[model samples]
Target: MKRFFSLPNEIFSLGLSPGALALYSYLLYCEDRKTYQCYPSYASIGKSVCMSVNTVRKYVAELEGRGLIITEPTSVITRDGRKHNGTLRYTILPIRNAVDRYNQRRLRQLEETVERMRIRKKLEGNEEHPA
Candidate 1:
């Protein structure tokens, strides 16, 4: 909501879209709440987090595009229940580094998408941009 993203701006001295932050928060929670520090494959992570693989892939792409996380694809277990040979790599940026980069990049993308609104204004204007 407007209240949540607004808090990041006030606390971090940078901007973060709700979606970008949701991805970051998930990574952080995986670390802080569940102690998952190793990189997570998109599919496994999706299952673990209870989000659809498509949603995970979408958010992971957003995180990578924002430089909040670095991602790579490997052959992971296929959908047919065969354990494949590879998996995707998702490296979360360090929190300190990600804070600024995620915000800055998200702000830039938001500026582009906002259509005649300042990034902050646009964010304040919408509460439901998802992860």
Candidate 2:
């Protein structure tokens, strides 16, 4: 897996908890296809980061509610093709009132992902293909 990236200290200005900021960073680390995009799973994330699933879930919920991130539970193909990895279709909602400007392009990527995943499942013949 690639190294995790920070959401920048400016993210804290969005009124997010430190845990939430970390979780949000992990989410980005997991989903980012550019620059250290590789990321661990929830279970791996929990263990690697030394947080219980319940605690991770709690902060995840907080991040969700705060509009710092968007999530939809779903299964995604693992980069290694070892097994299908379950992931949240997460899109960081840039705080318009804070640092950087809104990233409309990344938002479009999330939209496109939803559409692509819908198409992927259809083409998969519903077979588990080990991933």
Candidate 3:
């Protein structure tokens, strides 16, 4: 039996670095279809993606920063009745949300650029006319 998952085309346009894209794809592979969540240790993700644990951590942060996923710290109770930190729980957000955000950001940036160009043109015209 082969396992598979779909990667959204919008992801490529999200401007994620290669590492971040790989990590995000791995997380989607591990996530439960219904729950859209997965709990995998940094070591597990790193091994699957051929990245160092620290590198995995960095990509996880990048994904979170881009609103592609959300991570929650988990805890486990040992036989000694002591609580210890466990694997991080990752919840995959809808790709549409991320895409919308990315588009919005790009739109804002373009608008700002256009406004700057308009101002520069006005200033140049004023200089030429000496008014």
lDDT of 3 by residue, 1-131 (tens): 88899999899999999999999999999999999999999999999999999999999999998999999999999999999999999999999999899899999999999999999999999999984
Model 1 clash count equals 2
lDDT pick, better of 1 and 2: 2
Candidate 2's TM-score: 0.51
Q: Which structure among the candidates has the greatest lDDT? A: 3
Q: Write the per-residue lDDT of candidate 2 for residues 3-49, one digit (tens) a residue.
A: 75555566756656777777777776676655323335567768756
RMSD to truth, every model: 13.7, 18.5, 1.1
Task: Report the poorest 10 consecutive residues by lDDT, candidate 3.
Answer: 122-131
Assess candidate 3 and give its lDDT: 0.96
- Model 2, residue 67: distance off in Å is 0.6
The Cα RMSD in angstroms, rounded to one decimal, for candidate 3 relative to the true structure is 1.1
lDDT by residue (tens digit), candidate 1, 1-131: 33221223432444545555565666655542333244666676666667777887787777676555676566657678787656655565545675666577778988787775676676776766644
Model 2, CA-based lDDT: 0.66
Pairs of residues clashing in candidate 1: 76-86, 76-87
Worst 10 residues of 2 by lDDT: 97-106
| TM-score list, all predictions | 0.45, 0.51, 0.94
lDDT of 1 at 36: 27
Total backbone collisions for each predicted model = 2, 0, 0
